[model samples]
Target chain A: MDPSQVDVPPLKDLTIDNITDNVKLINSGCPDPRLKYLLERLVQHMHDFARETRLSHNEWMTAIQFLTSVGQICTDVRQEFILLSDILGLSLLVDSIDHPKPASSTEGTVLGPFHTHDAPPEPNGTQIAHDPAGEPCLVLCTVKDTEGKPIEGVKIDIWETDSSGKYDVQYEGREAPDQRAVMTSDAEGIFWFKAIVPVPYPIPNDGPVGKLLTLLKRHCYRPSHMHFMMEKEGFDHLITALYLRGDPYETSDAVFGVKESLLIDLGKVSAGQAKTYGVKEGGKLMSYDFVLVSEKESRELREKNAMYAMKDLGLRMKLYNGLPIPEVD
Target chain B: MDPSQVDVPPLKDLTIDNITDNVKLINSGCPDPRLKYLLERLVQHMHDFARETRLSHNEWMTAIQFLTSVGQICTDVRQEFILLSDILGLSLLVDSIDHPKPASSTEGTVLGPFHTHDAPPEPNGTQIAHDPAGEPCLVLCTVKDTEGKPIEGVKIDIWETDSSGKYDVQYEGREAPDQRAVMTSDAEGIFWFKAIVPVPYPIPNDGPVGKLLTLLKRHCYRPSHMHFMMEKEGFDHLITALYLRGDPYETSDAVFGVKESLLIDLGKVSAGQAKTYGVKEGGKLMSYDFVLVSEKESRELREKNAMYAMKDLGLRMKLYNGLPIPEVD
Candidate 1:
């Protein structure tokens, strides 16, 4: 049929109330049902947002320009859009939805932009921080399955900011993989490392996102935390962080990455007591136990369980329409 | 007060249900009340949209990438963001809201990307289309006040596509300002020009916006029309178009610029009959009359009237907060 000749109802003049439906109708031809659904909802909500706010033309233009700058500033190493998402708390929301953990297991958080796959593997108890000015600290972690069985030989990736709250990647003259290390758990599912106690610090604030934060009169600080990525042969890979309980920004982490289960106490240790854990005097000690859900159970829970049954229903609708299903991973 | 010492309430873990409130609280410090309201509303609606669609991480990433590409491709001559907005019907929606015309006045449409301020002025009946292949067209227009009194000495900027559905800007070898002309209405508020009968043309489809249209199984064609920017003393400047009735894409204009009042008949004139208007034989004739509201009424209607009282209220709030209010013009 000649689409142009088909008697389409004449569109009413553009209005706040009708614009959403009009845009949805325009996107009705999208072959990808998922994209169509996403776009329709986006248009509906965006139009509603604009109307509800009584957004001026200038405000809308400002948003367009801001988004443009964000896109223009993105590079291989820098993703301003992702940063925007993270600071907006969208990244963490997505993380939680995609990786709902059982009550017995550790919760996941955003895999922040700084994770690198090239950290050198070190034996247990190796010092990951070389900065002598940083306060010495000892971290011990044990990985176990939901049944409380130790998951030995799991590869654990660990990284943390320096005591000054700056990651190695943020330094202009830092060596490769500083303040980061990879290790395999021992027979007892125990992995320990010596490092500096990280301090809360502001995120990079020199770009457009920074300018927006300043305009909002908002601080850009993230709480002190240690990042961990643990993987075992038969368990779901866990990417999370353990934040220091008493950190100044613990209750207000900029990225909303903090979870009650992920907070740990940083116990101050005497010089002689620190020496027992192979750390220098006046250091801190932290011990955490991470529980992983089995891969089979995790997959089944996401695909067939009631927690995500709505998503499953959506996927089934897509399949019924003979559209290609997008890979969740 | 020491911000860090101030006891902030513990944040709930990020979830779909609470992400909106969380983001709103994060933006609570926004000194500019207008920006805060807009951003808060944006966050709420965007979060709601994400949840309503059960948007997957992959789909979200795809959207970010798509927006990034749109921003990267924009240049001085090309505005992909505007194109995106236009294709989605947002530009027209904004225009309609910002420039609400009374029923007696000619409605405004999009100020399309092709408008240039450098169009050379010519006397009435000047032949604007230099292309010999184009069918001759005679445009006769009258400008008037809302009461039908002729308003003389109005500058009318006119432009349109050639018979081949290509604008001068779209042609690599075209002369400067071809197919465009500026003219002034005479003492009687009468204006006339000779040009080609414009053909429906596809918008530039080589960019990300075009790709999006294709993915949506939608066409990018706009109906045959002549753009006009009419300005005179004591009246609001008007940016609008007169679409040729019976055009193939008149009902399906990709930009949603068509209005029932803007459609006009193009009566074919024989060579002998065309001499009356000083046009060559085998041309089309279109007579349109535009009515303009007084500037006083327009301003008062937009500001003090209930239709836009909410926007005025918002403006007052911005003023009270000492934020620079955006210029309505």
Candidate 2:
């Protein structure tokens, strides 16, 4: 008989809470220690959810669509799926659990949603932004080892949005890349940049990831922050982001990028003296030293730039299928 | 900034085998039990696979596409997706893991990729197919209770392919539903039918499922067999396929549906005796009976069917969005 032509059966009443035996069996078959443990745990939680909400097929399909969109919207520049991970708190948990940096070392936070590989190379203390589009501020920083001894001649790359919370490359209207620059730490492990105070801004949510947040009743704004990646001969290339302290949205940073140490106070300074530091007095200026643990090992120095990206296929039909599965970088 | 316009950073090296810790950490904050464990296991397997084969991103994408196709091609009638599950041994493993039938009782097998609900009612001893198609044989079957008592007046639905191992419905030029029929068990729990000895046949390999089998270098054929479903008031309904002993493809059953008890011997019989049994009785005939267990009090029985069905969206999506989650049957 044509199985396909048969009438559909009535729906069943399945849920997670009642499947302990089944879960046990599945676990028994999982030979991989990690996978076996995970399956056991995953199935347990799944069953618990089914039991808890009594979820329906329509709900399940809706989630499928949500995930599909997350994948579909992924591109080399953006990762909605990773954003989803961030919003769900999975990314934070992962970062925290994997990193056990000793005290005094710069704490690690999320790599935010955007991180460009290169910044225009600048010498020590060179200003990054070509123009001020936000509150003008002067930033100073120093690098040191865990022992608090200064480490000199280190490369530091810094990038951030203007007072408008916009990156230089973000503005197509910009005649040139405005706010990103590179610098080197001086003999005392000190370097400074002149730029506008960054402001809290909304993340790009016009796509499916935003739609999902709307559905989940979550906000799509990230706290204002600056990105930094420092590298010295034998030290772990530090990748981290610092958030503006007291930013109203800091508590609910969309990417959950804020950390206790990364949040810095942007104290106000007198206008004339601020001018000496390259900013209008009475505007916010901040100063802090980045104490990086010396490249402790070669492993950290060889770190891969942890950025999330997916392919886009809207090119011509000839390129639609993609480069015959091009080699993954 | 146009996120895509930034010079893309290199991706971190990740493998399926070494992802155990990654899964654990990523899901460390997941309050839901299943999602945490599932992600942990999935990551582990993914990393393990990567470590073992050094799989590239393109290959990973290929896997993602293959999984997507499995979901896309699935429908109520043609569950190629489920077949994919069976081929991967996931279905059987899941079924067995989730539903551990007593070793002494019928070992629940993969509910092959096809199953329909509405079957036209038929009476005891009524032949579903008139002409014998494959090997000529008489099917003898009786339903019994856990105590070995007879289950009289049970409804036994029957269907099988022809001597050439061709299912009537599988043929394009067919005018009728061949090699199929339904009959009820008599008061003595006995039922018999005459049909041609069936031949082994290959499963449909035109779809992505076939492509996977080819990629995995597996044979895609199954030994000829009869399908049956028996139900009565006192015991749980049994839905199972019975394989013909000595069928050429028995060892290589495509979906691995073979069971020791389900195999029926195909033996020669005298012509007059065949006439007595209402069969032509010259050639080989495959025959077998079915056994079913009684329904027990549990939450899983009510929802087992739904849980297995909802897994088409991948384990993660199923946990998040798919609902009406079935209990382990």
Candidate 3:
């Protein structure tokens, strides 16, 4: 034995009881306090989960391979990881935690993989579905503050799948985008648009997320719904969706985006009543009122802005540090 | 109001307390009981971790992007996901749990990312290092069963980094593989090889795992050590390494592959003592004896074999089911 090395300590053997602490120690040097805290908790939970499951080495390797496939399948137009998060109900959980809405305001859901920044703006009552193949539905929506007062000029960005349950992006060789529009509320905070009744649609199922759902023996269909992102200068932005009543998948949306307040009745209207809104006979008229919450205080607004600025700076640093540019929208 | 649709149940709101249950419910349809159990525990821990950290939307997105990058960077030659697991101390934890050694047997560690099937076989006492780069070290190891009797004819596969801490794979244009050899134990269960003193080396640091280590302010160097895989019929395979005592990183291996019993003294030997092993002048010698556990009862072995067969069938089904081929090794 070498005397110089005789003083070396024996390796601290790791066990189920000690593994969490060992991992925590490994992450103790994280420079950012928040990052450190997150990693520590993450390590703890991950180990606990593994132990609780008695995860075999083979199972763990399978998980690693699954996640790798999820990442590799992602493209400029697709985000399989985000889809995994959605189906796992993580997306909604995060959204709910981040944006706790008052009872008077609209409930939020996931910003499912479809939102785009360059939505075409059109006047109120414009027909969003250029060539409708489903029942004509007239959407009459009113935007209001918590006090029930009108909050005019709020931007309401909307998008949905067509009668065939396909987004414009899903179609090949499509000439123009359909089933989407951006419109602003009027002086009365009332907005209306002509669109087909959005049908229940399966999320992109050819990817790893779909395979996971299949393996889990779960359906991949989301309830028929219209996605909406309502925003204004002072109010908090709301990313939510209105699930149509009577949709079979309403009770079990694969992405779990459903909420009581977000469900609406698409009641049938008389031909005369439909004509009043420029809809053809036998059309449906659905009326919804979205309530927004005003900014709480100047200091709170300033803090929020600062947080966003910090996030932007961190993102820039990550980019400058040679991190891969994420293709997320 | 649409009376026909009035019977739908109210959406089950998800709170921090209920998010875990919601995710569990989503996975309730999984046919495999083991998979269902694992996913339930995994979902619970993941949600708890996120909630405990109060992870913000931006931070969550950042994590997703990080994992995506890790998956994207993996290739047949590299496994960024495994590297991530190693740095997080998960790989060792799993290995320790899966392979609990008896008190008399040698402890096991991580296989690491460096093991290859193309290692050249050599005769006993063969010099693995073709040229002089560092101080010569002769490794003499014996294989045995738990009874302490010699177990000959066991394959002993070995590999390590050169004196400069560079593996043969890391070199741009290597003339031949270095610091690696495969040999079998003789009648006395003894095997010997000559090679340069293995030096501590940093893991591949150009990938996302390296970037993560940097972000965590953690070093990426593993302690200087050797790799070994000893296997024979009717006995468990042992994948482990011998850590060099007194190495600076011994106490803080980046991959946490160190164990006290696995640590040994590389004692300096006199020229006279070295001549017996064909070493020139001053040299070092390391003597290690690996004891493997015998296979359990026939019932246990049969059960294990059946479980593995089921896993193989599942994997084949997954492939035939149109899941993307994973690019990870």
Candidate 4:
């Protein structure tokens, strides 16, 4: 063995090249061809971007901390990160890319922060509101086919906030789901739920996401509205929500989930129409209908079960062994 | 407020498209465009990578932990992460892209981990070995123009290990810069350092880098070689090391810092050449002459400092909110 080769010093680490390497590892092997390409290109671009911005470890850790807080704030009723996604226009961008509308049917908007499948179905024109003090209202919805023909017997699942701006899931269980009800349309593809108009309110922020907003100089509130889950034969399942006529976050919902057609006006009805719905004289009420296109699924359909926390645990174990998983549970 | 316009959640503070908006409070800008681009890209990719990989909170924290350990392992004498860079071939890629050499000049290898810029200069044909146990050798060199014509007054700053396989910096200040020395040549650009043949040795592996290597299933040793810094007016500054032929790491040096021209063979020398260098009749040494071309200033010179660490500190601070710093100083 020639003795002269041993004593030289090693070079410096943390060069731009190595940083790029670690990022590539994150893109190891995604199943989705398009997602894989997007992620690979994104990883390359991000590494180049980080190197270009000269982002420091100190700053990166803060971002991690903020994301953690965003996760922490999420619960059965709230998803602040989704709100963040909407406002950033990422969700809208993805949604539009995945589901481009032709502008004829009811515009699809974000499925606002609260939605649950299989809500208890109520009879047509029945009051879904548990709060007697909420503004007396009606939600008349028409489930239409592509040709604008009303599709009778279509199931339109509905959930929303009460007059106090709180969801039923937020309260105790065993009573029926408050502000949450399901309705099936009649022969005209028209379905109406007797209820109260939702109140506008801000999303809960008392976490790192809030801290992030302070750093970015922005606000955190979502306009109030009812959510809709509808399914029809030969059409994709629609998970969407409609917005009220007037609220502050109309243009800048934190989740950027709004679409132009989803906005609807609840016009005042004549006393003659109100009497048919058992409304007292001078009682305030509203009605509107929604149109849903087939909702295409983007990601591989992972079995979504009630044991979400367990699924999250399982996913973590998988990745610890260097396996990859989607961020959702 | 038009309630119809209000279905979206309010925009929040978690995202920003520009780095300057956050860094502006500090009044500093990144100098290198590529570095800037890299840092920005890194941040974007890492976040997306984390999101895509569903990099969990604990996992993200674990990464931060791993990085800190990597940092803690770095010292004045050893840099395992840098060694990692070398082994991964990142350093070579950088060196190759930045320093393209012509076919005529001595090729550049890694500036191994133990370089101290100021070596004492020696006269032409001077003996550089402090121990007589080294191989008795002669390095006859001829410096010339790119066309092979000789040039004068060339200086060759050289340093290398001794027969014991240790560097001056490897051990404490007990030995006076063992087998390494600086030397200048005649008007022709030819000079050599006479040192005992050094043995190959393993780099420091008792730290974080060592731990990482253990995890990565990699070795921590490098081949033996002498460090060389060839600088002249009009020639590109070549900071490189020469690898002795036949060392084990000559093929798999933990740093992968080897080049073809860097490989040199040591043979027995004549009594007449030994007498000229003041070596005894049968001393141990070898001979090597470096041929260099007119060094071109690196093209990156037109660019600013492109290192990501400097470019990204603010982002680090912003993300981590004051990450713990290593007590290296």
- Tell me the whole-model lDDT of each prediction, alpha carbons only: 0.75, 0.55, 0.75, 0.54
Locate the minimum summed-lDDT window of 10 residues in model 2 chain B. Answer: B8-17
Misplaced by over 4 Å in model 3 are A1-12, A118-136, A171-182, A267-281, A284-286, A295-329, B1-12, B117-136, B168-182, B268-281, B297-329
Q: What is the Cα-based lDDT of residue A250 in candidate 2?
A: 65
Summing lDDT over every window of 10 consecutive residues in candidate 2 chain A, give the lowest-scoring window: A315-324
Candidate 4 residue-wise lDDT at B258: 66
Name the DockQ score for candidate 1.
Answer: 0.35
How much does candidate 3 score in TM-score?
A: 0.80
- Please write out the lDDT profile of model 3 over residues B302-329, one tens digit for every residue: 3343344336434321111111111221
TM-score of chain A of 1: 0.81
- DockQ for the candidate 4 complex? 0.05
The TM-scores, chain A only, for the candidates as listed are 0.81, 0.69, 0.81, 0.74
Clashes by residue pair, model 1: A271-A281, B271-B281
Query: Cα lDDT for residue A166, model 4?
Result: 75
lDDT digits (tens) for residues A1-329 of candidate 2: 12223221221111132234433342343334333333444444444444333433334335545545555555545556556655554454444433335566887666555666556778755667655446666777889887788888888878777766666545545455557777888888888877777777877677776764454345666777888888788775676777787776666565556677888888776766566666566766677778776544322321211111112322111111221111320
Clashes of each: 2, 47, 1, 102
lDDT of 2 by residue, B1-329 (tens): 22223221221221222224533443344445444444444445434333222222334335445545555555434556566655544444444433434434455555665444544556543455655333356665676665666677777766666656555555566555555666777776677766555567767687787875554345577777767767677565565677766765665565656666667676676787577666566655544444556666212443443355445433323232332421321
- Misplaced by over 4 Å in model 4 are A1-14, A18-35, A171-176, A257-260, A294-329, B1-329
Q: After superposition, how far is residue A254 of candidate 3 from its true place, in Å?
A: 1.4
Across B38-76, the per-residue lDDT of candidate 1 in tens digits comes to: 777667776666555555566667877788888887765
